[model samples]
Each structure stands twice: as C-alpha cells, then as structure tokens.
Target: MVRASACGRPFVREGAVSAFPFDAVIFDMDGVIVDTEYYYLGETAAFAKELGLNLTQEELNGQVGTSHQFFLRMLVDWFERAGKGHLTGEEALIRWDEWAHKRPRDYQALINPGAVDTIRELPRRGVRVALASSSPMDSIEEVLNACGLSDAFEYVVSGEQFKESKPEPDIYLHALDLLGLPANRCCCVEDSVPGITAGKRAGLTVIAKREERFGFSQDAADKIIDQLPELLTLS
Candidate 1:
C-alpha cells in the first residue's frame, strides 16, 4: 500500500480479488473532470470562422478528446481547400496559440460537482488515481488548480507529451506506465469517443460520462454514468 500525502489517503495493490477487477483509476480531464469542453469548442469554432471556415457544432463536438496539434493540422487542411494553401500547420498552430493565450480568464469554468470528493475517496479505498488528458500541461495545471484538484491525482500526464494522442492509446499507456500498474488492473474514465477508444485500446475498463455534449457511445465504453459520484460504486 502507498499513501498519498496531498489527500492523506492510501492506495493498495493487493493480489486479485473477486469483487473488483481494477486496482487503479485513470481520469481524463477536460469534460470529465471539468466543464471546459464548451470553452474549447467555442474557441476552436471562432478560430475556424476567422479563417473563413464554418464549423458545425456536431463537427466541433467530434473533435473532442483530440490533441491541439491534430485539430490545428485539420484546420490547416481546411484552409488549404479554401485556397489558403500557403498556410502550413505550424502557422495555424501559432495563430491558434496566440488566440488561446489571449483568451479571457472568465471563459474557463470550474465545474466538477463530485470530482473532489470522489478523488479523495478513491485513495482511501485502495485505488490509485491518475490524470491522462490530451490538454497541454499549462491548460491542465490551470484547470486542476482552478478546480482545487491539483493534489487529487498521483500522476499527471498530458497528451501533448506523447507523439500521438487519444484513439492511439499513447496517453493512457503512458499513464499506466507511470502508475506502475498493468492495463488489466486499471480502469479509465472518459467523456469523449476518442478518449473512450484510447482507454479501450489500452485494455482498461472504460467508464464513459454520458452527460457531456459529445463522446457518448455504448460501443466504446464498458459502462456509462451520468455523474461522477456514480463511480464510487464501481468496486
């Protein structure tokens, strides 16, 4: 058993038990830990519009759980089709980076209804907790700090650190590596299709949050929940 100093809770890794198949829980940050999906979608949509491209809500929603680089590349392709073939992916990224950096502070929201309590409870119940998100480190830090969840996780991994993001399983695979746990002993919580696909690909039990505006499918998830608190009953 290992004890977490931040929350004063213990995580145990015992031999297989019949009741619970997992010994750890991995979390996806954006839509699952915080209500920031709307902000991201709005920002991306606005950026696309400025480039003379129209992005529908559904199309924007489909891009959830993807890395910024992936979306930037897609934007560059869109611009190319619109006769802006001179603009490279790097240029689009730079512009988007500037826009993101200059975003209003109030545009981000901190809403994780039962996140704090659930995370705090997990450690004491002998389950390791980790954060795996496609968001950049700076964005992850801001959200975690804003939501008072900076100390809730044992490990934090950003998809930006990986060459490939969600749907490729690199982030989740890296997180399990950091946790020192095997895939079968961990469960992943996600709120987007890409996230769910990543978790499943990593061989972890996936719990999909169904309340988010995007990423809800029975095919990609092992189970579905409408609220964070419901995860407490998994064991």
Candidate 2:
C-alpha cells in the first residue's frame, strides 16, 4: 500500500509500475524537454567574452544543467585560473547576468525531435510525468508554454526553489515528493551529467540521453538512448 503525504497527494500514479519498471517519470527541462542547451552554451560563451575572457566549449559544457550561482562561481574560478584574478566576483556576476538578459527573446531554442508527440503519448499509456529543472521558473514556463508542453506535466519543479541544485539529490527528491512515489518507483530522464547524478543520488532509475556535443558517460545511467523517442517504449 502506498502512503500519501500532503506534498504528494495531487499526483496520480498509474500503469503497471513497480520497482523494476518505475511508476512516475521525471524529466530535466533544458536538454530533455527542449533543446535549449545550445542557447545556454552560446549565452555563457558570449558572457565570458564580454568579460574579456575566452571560454572554450569544453569549459561551458561543464556548467550545463547547473544553477546560476554555481555557474557564476565556476566562472569566477575559471577567471582566476586564466590569470584574470583581478576580476572581482561582483563584476563577473554582473556581466554574466547582463549578457543572459540581453539574449534575444525570439530566438528559437532547439526543439528535440518527437518531443511533443512523446510527451502527449505518455498519459495515454498510463505513465505520470513531471519536469524537474535547474532553470528559473519564468524560463521553464516560457519554454514549456512556447513548445506546447505546458500541460503535459503534472508538476514542474524549479531548481531555483531549492538551496541545492544538480549533483545533489534535492531537486529529484523534491520531484518524487511532489509525485507521492517512492524513489524506486520513479524513473528520471536527463541529458547531462549533473542531472543524472541528482537522479541517481535520489535513488531513482535513471535514463541518460546521449548528447554528442557534451559527451556524457553511461556508467551512472540505468539505461541510455540517443533520443527522447526511446522513452515512449521504455514503460
């Protein structure tokens, strides 16, 4: 028998979900739900350049799916490493935020192939889905609404709502709490290393989406796929 907590009562668990198959599906927003990775990467690079720092693709890749504070801290560390120790923490943060806000709002972030169809199909198959991301609430809402996925998930969790982000279990744990399911009864889908780490740490089964540019390892993920379409068949 499943015991319901006040935090988890509104979510429904359907289908033949058990320890092996997983009952609820939790997703990471940026790369998993939509292809916003490139936009974020480009923005980060441009922000670094504006600070008179040349940030390589490799450096930017390491910060994907992380919170803004983490990204800023990493940038500060990188600046020091690049012999730009004169740049203060406040200066770096101001420049990064300025660049982020200046990105054109009309830019179409990459939408993954078959994302809409897959999300739409999940409910018919009796699977419960939710979104767990490190992005701000406003950004998540904009992307989901823009991509027509706003109504697909029963819950949308923002990493900004938590003190800890990916690589920590807080976000995933929070999602599971919202879903009213045990860790073993949930499946987490993620496209980045930190997202995967968060899911695994929360004790949920993890599916890793292979991103060619980021080069994620398969060791931590329970299942690996090259695209989001594969998830439709997993449950």
Candidate 3:
C-alpha cells in the first residue's frame, strides 16, 4: 500500500509506478472544488420566483452539472410552463444572468474545505492534475482566479467548447485527450449525478464528493469522499 505524507514526500514500495495509483486526475469545478452549486440553485430559484415562475428547488436541481446551452433550454421550458413561452431560451438566460450579476457571489469564500490543499498536493504525490467543468471558460477562469487556483491545473477545459456536456461524456473524454492519458489511468472528482455518469461513461474512475442536497444520487460513482483531501488516502 502506498501513502502520501502531508508534508514530506510520498512513500512507495519497490516497483510501484507512483505513490498515487492514478497517473492524472481531472476535477470538476462547481460542487466538487467550490461550494457554488447551492448558491447557483438558490439563484436559479430566486430568478424564477422574481419572474413569477415559481420553480421548485427540485426543478432547479435539474440544471445542476449541465452545460450552458442545456441550462438555457431548461430555463425556456420552465418559463413556458409559467406562461412565458414568448421568451426564447437565449433571452431567458440573458435575463437570468443580468439578474444574477446584480448580487454577485464571492467565489473565493465558497472554496470547499481542503480543496486547495488537495489540488496542490496531488502533484506532489506524482499525479498530474487538470480541470473539466460544464461552465463556460470565462466563468471557469473567474472561479479559478478568485480561489487563487489560476496555476493549479496543467489543463482546463470547458463544456461550452463541446457539442454535449457532462451526461454525454464529451467534456471528460476531451479532458482525457488533452491530458494524453487513458481513462483507466485517471480519475474525476465530481458531486452531481450527471458528472458521475459522464466520468463512468468516459471509462474513468469517478470519485464523488458527497452531496446529499438537491435530491441527487451519487450511487454511480466508483468512490465517495466527504472532503477533497480524502483523495490522499487512495492507493
């Protein structure tokens, strides 16, 4: 068994490829790295309420781990249900974004416990790190920079660049391609059902950060951990 020391170098037995089992790790930003999923759900529900749409939390939860385009379509469907069918998905997204910007969240304060330490420590354990998020690149950059993680990942990919998002596995597959690692050689950290499904579909080990809220099921994940630094215990 290999173990990584908190402060010193990782320990490995003879002929071990590395202290960590995986060659690389790819992280998801929202619920896994930062505690922004709850905030986003709140914002989504509030925005719908302001529009008199009365969307339930369960309804907004459907948008979690989705691409920007998929979210827009969800907004359109929700609005149409509230008799606002005249508004297109794009128009609805614009309105929602404008509303959300009025009271912007401080992303730095939302960094999950041990997230930074875990990300920084993985490389020290002989693992390369990357990030793949359903967020647009601008949003990804903003969160990363705010959390003082601008240099954290060797590569960062956004689902906005792909034709499909999480549940479709395109983003994670693309991240694997970018890292030049096979899915079996890497793992993905995620908290949402769609993200877990994506990682599994991509043939990577999916480690879920336990998330009981938002009516999500993480049963599909290969492993579950309460905090980011728990990853250090693997292998």
Candidate 4:
C-alpha cells in the first residue's frame, strides 16, 4: 500500500484505505504515543541479562504490542524452558513487579516526538480522540500526567480493564462505544501488528506507526507512517 504524504501526494502501491470520514481517533500508547516500548524492552532485557537469560531481538519482538501481564508470563515461561531460571511462575511474577517498582519509567524522556501536538490538533480539526492502550491503568495515568496530556483525550481506556487485549478488538471496541462513534468514523493509531489487527477487526481504519524498535510488520494495517505528526495531514 502506498502511504500518502502530508501534502496529499500518493506513491506507487496497491493498498488504499477509505478517504477521511474519521470523526474520532483511537491511539495505542506505547510506541505510538509515549515511546515507552524501548524503556520496557531495555528494562526487561537488563533483568533477563542479570539472570543469564539474554533475549534475542526476535524474542523481544514477540513481547511487543501486548499487555505487560501477558508479556511477563511469556518471559517467565521462556526463562524456565531455556533452563535459565528455576523460579516458579509466581516467583517470576513477583520479581517482575519488584523490578517495575524499582525502575519507574522516565516519561519525559520517552514521550514520542510530535505526539502531543498531533493529539491536541485533532480536536481543532473537529475530531474527537480517545486512548486504547495495553498498559496497566497506573502506567497509563503516569504517561498521561507526565506527558501533560491528561486532559487532551476524551476517554482513556486500558486493556487491563478489558477481558482481552490487542488482537482481540475489545479495547478499541470499548473506546468506540465510549466515544459514541462507529468504527467507520474512527481511526486507530497503532505500532504493532496485534494492535493493527484489533483496530481492523473492530472495523476502524488502522494507521500503523512505523518504528524499528519492535522489528515487526505485516499487511494487517490500513495505513503506515514514519511518525506521529505525519498523521496531522489526515486530521
């Protein structure tokens, strides 16, 4: 699929998303908005390395675009299967919690460039905005408060509040419901395949925020862009 430029120029490609009717935008937090993906990865990798359970790039990619709870389980399982740790699942989870508390993310350093402006600009364009994130509520709150955008969104829903996370469409669907907007009138901003899947499955137009931090991609999205403000044109 060809990506459109801010000036509305289209390059050669086969993919085409429906032109704008989006009255609302649903954003995924990690790589798309707060740029917390790398911080999470760095912290996880350091913890794994300390246990002699260094994760390869592929292993890291496997954990991206999902809730921290799921990621922790997966990491613990990997640690056991790889003969890297003797901790029980419960013990492993405790270790993760301890580490998270010890190393709270520095939200200011991680905020994605152009993210705030992009979000604030939406309302001016007559578009409503909400957040659908896989992070826990506390983490989401910290991000919103630290980024100085706690009031920018109309609604903020965490996947932790839902029965399912990304790739399940629950969070996005909930956001749409709360916004009182249909999928066709909303745009989903995502940075991973699972997030894209959730958005598309919810019948919303999905815009993939391209980043190399995860090194994962496929044909599941409706659009792709290199950064956040690149979407300002669509707004």
Give the best candidate by lDDT. Answer: 3
Q: In model 2, which runs have C-alpha deviations exceeding 4 angstroms?
A: 1-20, 75-97, 105-109
**lDDT digits (tens) for residues 90-197 of candidate 1:** 887776678778876552355767877887777676677888888878778877777777877887888877787888898888877767789989999988778888
Which numbered prediction scores highest in TM-score against the true structure? 3
| Deviation in Å, model 3, residue 68 alpha carbon | 1.6
lDDT of 4 at 10: 21
| TM-score for each of the candidates | 0.83, 0.82, 0.89, 0.83
Which tens-of-lDDT digit does each residue in 69-109 have in candidate 4? 58757767867866867766578877778767987678978
Stretches of candidate 1 above 4 Å error?
Answer: 1-21, 78-85, 105-108
Query: By descending TM-score, how would the candidates be arranged?
Result: 3, 1, 4, 2
Per-model clash counts, in order, read: 0, 0, 0, 1
lDDT of 1 at 207: 93
Model 3 TM-score is 0.89
So what's the TM-score on candidate 2? 0.82
Where model 4 places Cα greater than 4 Å from the true spot, the runs are 1-20, 78-91
lDDT of each: 0.76, 0.75, 0.83, 0.76
